[model samples]
Target: MTKENMEEGVNQKNVESTQMKEEKKIDEEDTKEAEKVNLTKVTTFEELLEVVGTRGKWNVLTFLMCILVAFTSPLQTLSYQFLGATPDHWCQVTPLLEANWTHQQILDLAIPFSNSTGRPENCYMRDYDYTAAAALGYQTTMKDPSAVLRNSSSLIQCSVREFNLSQYISTVVTEWDLVCERRVLYSTTQAVMQGGKLFGFVLFAYLVDALGRRPVVLVCSAISIIAGFLAAASPNIEFYIVLKFIIAAVDAGQYLGIFVFVMETCASKYRAGAGTLIVIPWAVGYMVVPGIAYVIRPWKLLQVAYTVPALYTIIYFWLLPESPRWLIDQGRYQEAFKVISWVAKVNRKPLPADQVVLAAMENIYHQKAQGKEADSATKTFTSRLLNLLKQLLSLLLISELRVRTIIVFFCWFSASMVYYGIALNATNLSTDPYLYIFLGGLLEVPSYLLLWPALIYIGRKKSLVALYLFCGLCIFSVMGLMLTYPGEAEVAKVFFSQIGKMAVTAAFQLAWMYTAELFPTKFRSLAVGQASFCARIGSTSSPYINDLLGPYTVWAPSALFGSVSLVSAALAVLLPETRHCDLPESNDFFTKTKEAGAEGREQGVVDQDEGVLNPSFVSEAGETGSQIHPRKSDTH
Candidate 1:
């Protein structure tokens, strides 16, 4: 054994050891890859269907429940539409009568008139006479022979000196303006009605999340029914407005509860589609409003049209079950199991009882692990409030969540401006105002149908941005046409504006789905409520902006909203695409940043964090072993 032979022998042993080690590592990797494939194969659509079939009866009931809940949006919006015309007709008749009165005199006259006649005080005519004194260029002091003849020649001749008949006639005219004018009463009533909508939005979100969807919605339906009847029976503007406001508030509850309920019931795979489906009712409600207003004619009659839907909603209470997902979240495992079992039975296949129990146990364990308890005390006033605040802050901070929220808010704001603007300006367009409004609303149906498919296929960011941009472009184009052509192309302008309204309505529907998909399950309702709250602010501001800018001064709100949407679209580019990604557990931006770099090993260090390394580009010194092992390397 020479020194050279011994060295060669040692080298051979080391080579064999290295080769064997490599083979073992390859075998281990293959085993892990096989296990991953097996795990992926465990769940299938057929098995899911089988489980669903075993509880077929319950599934049908749950499906119907979701549909019923989804129906509330249309019901509430349509009801508002039906009752909407009272103010419109009244606004038309006011200014003709109050021609020469001071504001103080009008106010003084309106208070007594409102009390005695049961109308709103604000509905009194403004100080403008369009027909006689102003339009014909006649002064109050000029007494024409024809006016004298119309009043009575004998009285006219006697009143010139003795009777002071002109003074009496002036008092009569002023009284008539205050007491008998529909516009004066309608204005006051509309204010109250609008205030009710504001209160409704704020309160309904809290109530629905607290009380559970079924009970709250049933209560809402009942309130709406009673309010509808009260509105129909009212003999005066005060009662009508008061009742209308109550109706609007309850309708808000219906809107909030139904959407939450339906979305909760749907499977994760179809949740976005189901959420989007809820908005279709709003479009339908909008379309139905004008037609019902036309058919009903008088405001009182329209109240009856609104009440009919309330009756249907009341009946729906009996047909629909409570949302099982909500029940599960509340830690009512027995109820969840019963509902799931029923779903399986309805699908006409047996559920694996042990698996069902195991799933329930796992859910309970997770809930406990998260420090959540079934007791109501655990969801106390302070705790729930804190949780809500935390959720709101999280939504605001998370880039993806913030982007979706902003887009939804702007879209909602724009849609509300255009939708309500069109409805308000219907009288300016044609004699058959309701028909035009109805037609505009009817166009949203196809748009709604097209929305979900586009979202699923094209992805959320593109669909939302595209819809928003299209809507903004439509509005801007309509504004351009209105400004440049004016009366010459009045009909064309109206048609174009209506098209913009429809496009915005579609965008609004899609945005709701997009917002829902951006947030996790735990904060789903809270995120929705906050976004909706921002939207309500937009809606609340629309009327004031319209009044300030004038409906024809379309550029103010149109440009403002369009700019908002454009900015949101740009910000949407910053959001990570969520169409295929699982909803994140926490909104930790750094976690997402780190995960972003996980795909490519050649990428540089994303941050100064431990366990992170830049493998591709290193210092020109001798390479370290740690740098080659990215998983084990520490950059910090």
Candidate 2:
């Protein structure tokens, strides 16, 4: 070994050692930078969720507020069944004749009894002068004793003079002369209210976005109470109908506003399941309506009774908290922090020290500042409304979302139509209407209970598809029984119909969950509002559709509802399975071509540490490709 060769070897070893040391120092610096990035990037509200215990005092309080607010929906909507109830009615006998004749004799003389049903035909009456007949010597007998009727006397529809409502103590149907030729008007009133609801949903969504959710509910509750009280004292059917529309419009806002607030405030882990349970109060409300109606019986008093509860909900204004998400979205960080602090205190959770929380909030403020900004120029109400509409329409032009949006809209429409159609028809049954409605509402509880586990286990798409098809089949079977056995199958028909109602109830809940999962955050509220609008349209038409087709044949509307549902079940198959999948956050996150292939993949991993990923987690790497995945909040 020469001296030069040994020196060369040592120099190379020294150089290698220096390079290794430099690399180690660089690696340590990178590690520290990564830690800093994570500490500052508090992208999701879920991180602070633990500090305010997930299910504790805050959640319990929120649940009560949500349930209380929801009770008005079924009360206002279904109370019409009792308010507009029609008992056996006939044409009013003139006062001149009634002075001498008994009630049975007056009815026997004026109304033409059907040999088939042994009851007077509701519309037709003998065109004889009952007053003149009584003036001369007349007495109604078991046989056709009237000389005018003994000869072939023609029948005529009742004039607008008056209606006999002796059988009914009181009902809007008889009071408004909404029987015989005007029977269709009774159903029309319900449809009009539903139309009002459709408009209200669109209007209130904007109000909620511009204002806060809490204030909108408070204002709506006040409006509903006033409208309802006035409606009970309506001078005529037209006035009552208009008031119903107004009450329905205001109540619709209350229903959805509280729903959004509840979803936003609930813990992320429990959100998907919690939404299913929210309908429990709505079901209970329906159940209570029948009992109230049975006790009150009269239409005017029943309406007043239903309206009184809205006054009770007014107290919730103090109890309900403004949604924390809305506060943060509006750049009110201090208010949001205060709410979080309150939640933590009520839950008895160990929150970080004041400095720690303040530091974390500071990070949140900075992150929000760096993110997207609402345009200052577009701050006006009109501009915001236009912007919201534009964003909603943009969803149609988006890639993968376009198909999903349309499909979900149809599913929502079908679900709502079938649900309300069945509900309204149950009132027309020959059996006890109140008991029937109560039983129907009772079934809703088990449906939601069954849906919870199904959503968690069998997955969303399969569960929805199964529910749609099962309900559709049950509905069609009821139609068949009405055609096949007609008389003997009454009990079986009702049983299957209730089953169908239960199935559709589950499908309706699943539809909301499925649609919410499909849209990105930017258009989530708009998308949901649009879907609800579509649903309202279907529900609006439901009463008239049932009524119009019912006279022709019960099977017509039944087949129509069943076929649409079956088609919806087929459509559900086309939707990408979203079980455990992250919700999308932006329009750009979706691919140009739809990925039906993705549905075949495992439901995807739910990272407890990071929270659920956006639906487009794998495709759009732009916003999501940063250090951490975006946290999927149920509010969006």
Candidate 3:
């Protein structure tokens, strides 16, 4: 009886064991299949990022961090407008002031009225004996000593500078006496800052590539903060200029590093609006500066306030995530995996198989290695120059491409020149420079929002022309008001300036997109890079035009900007509209002047460029999704 029961129990146990083995076998097969699918899915880290979930919490956090880094960048660029501004200064007559003679009396006793404007001369003073004038109670022997000097026969340049610090407690202009003849130093400093920005972008690009973006940006930001503090305490203009150049350069790296990090980490889908998103945060940063400066009053304290914000970026060391792409490139696969897995988890998505991820990373490592080998093989500098020259030739030599390239380059230049011109003169537009600057920043946001709609309904070339036309007209109005009502119409001038600012800003966004659409894939990056170079030239020259022409006339900058904008508008009309047209692949495509047909316009194009410009449904997905997030605006 015991033997029969024991044999039955053993049979049941064997059946249970077989079922468990089958389940395990099935699980193993499913994992292997998943691994096989995932292993070949992506060869690069960027592709791997998309597979792991791209536009998620990780990406959002990264973008916000980048924005924080960008928030105070405008300070380095625009601060000089305020910090180097010449206040209501006059020739110093200290003895007259000590003798109970009022400012009006001293102004009259020593300063003469300008013949042209009937206003007191700020840079010129009469060779009057202040002791004798005060001894005489600065009376009519000086002929309206309370109003104007008696004679302009013996005029001299200001010997002792006295700044009226009612607006700013201190500035480079006031502290260093950079007024009148020395005023060009203000423009010189601004130009140097622009150069520093250019150099910083180039330097940081290399640094981030070598040391990784997270650390490089953070370290540079710290250095930038220190430099800013040192600048606040700068003993002289020479020292201040050196520190400012350093701040501008370091700030560029601060922005460039985080920007590159975000771009690498962001999905392709978000990269388009990356332009708009990227700029607004910087604008916000710029918008706040006026308020901060207004409250701080003193230039040194305002600098401290501006410099302290950069310290907020120090939290980046703890909160800022490193680019997974960078880590894998550095062969830090394990750390990259951990970051990727965290991203997937936060995004509520499953990750690719571990082995597959490791394999993809290894493949990317080899690809990077091959790239470095290629660079080394080419020997770096010489190859880059030759490639650059070849690109230049391709742009200039081709028939239709050459004219289009030139027109687009002008568009870039005019847009940048007008943009920086209006921006730099924000303070001069109104007595309340803070409000002028704040409103300028506020108004720019709508221009970006309206850009896509403008491109959609108004057509590209026409929209660009309209923006330039509007900007030019507004700037001209500003010039007229300044000339016609120099004493009044501050509000009107500020309002027109804001309108011009918005239009130029829209034109800037349009120019960026228009240039990309104008060129083919072959020359797109090179064209954009060259355009950026041209834009830098325009921006670099703007400060000089603003400050140098200031002594000649207050409206001189406006006149120049308005003229260039109008000319640019006219030039824009000559450019063939790119709206709904295929991106030409070669110079020959431009030579074929025939417009795209109705169906191509309605449904998108193909035969226009032939092979690459596909109108297929699959191609539509990539193009359409990205279109929703176009590069509407980008910060300089």
**How does residue 525 of candidate 3 score in lDDT?**
42
lDDT of 2 by residue, 360-386 (tens): 666644444453545667768999888
The backbone clash count of each candidate, in order, is 23, 2, 0
Q: Candidate 1: how many backbone clashes?
A: 23
Q: How many backbone clashes does candidate 2 have?
A: 2
CA RMSD of all predictions:
18.5, 14.4, 8.4
Steric clash pairs (candidate 3): none
TM-score of 2: 0.82
lDDT string, candidate 1, 204-264, tens digits? 7666655677787788878888887776677555666678678777776676667766655
Those runs of model 3 whose alpha carbons end farther than 4 Å from true positions after fitting are 1-47, 94-101, 115-118, 131-152, 205-212, 322-339, 358-412, 426-431, 452-466, 477-492, 509-533, 550-555, 566-636
Least well predicted 10-residue stretch by lDDT in candidate 1: 154-163
What is the C-alpha local distance difference test score of each model? 0.52, 0.73, 0.70
- Predicted candidate 3 versus true structure: per-residue lDDT over 1-636, tens digit per residue: 699999999999999999999989977775565555565735445467766676777667767767666677876677776677668888887778789887787775677777865667878888766666777776654765434444446677876777777766888788888877787787877877876765675556556666777887788878888998888898898888888878877876776667656655765344445645666766787788677777776778777887877778778878777778678867899988888878877775555578767888888666445413233345689898786465456678766578878988888888888898888785455466677778878887888777766665556777888999999999999999999998689889888988998999988867766675676534554565566556667887888887677556788899999999999999988776554443333333343332323334433332222211212112234553112212224111
TM-score of each: 0.66, 0.82, 0.74
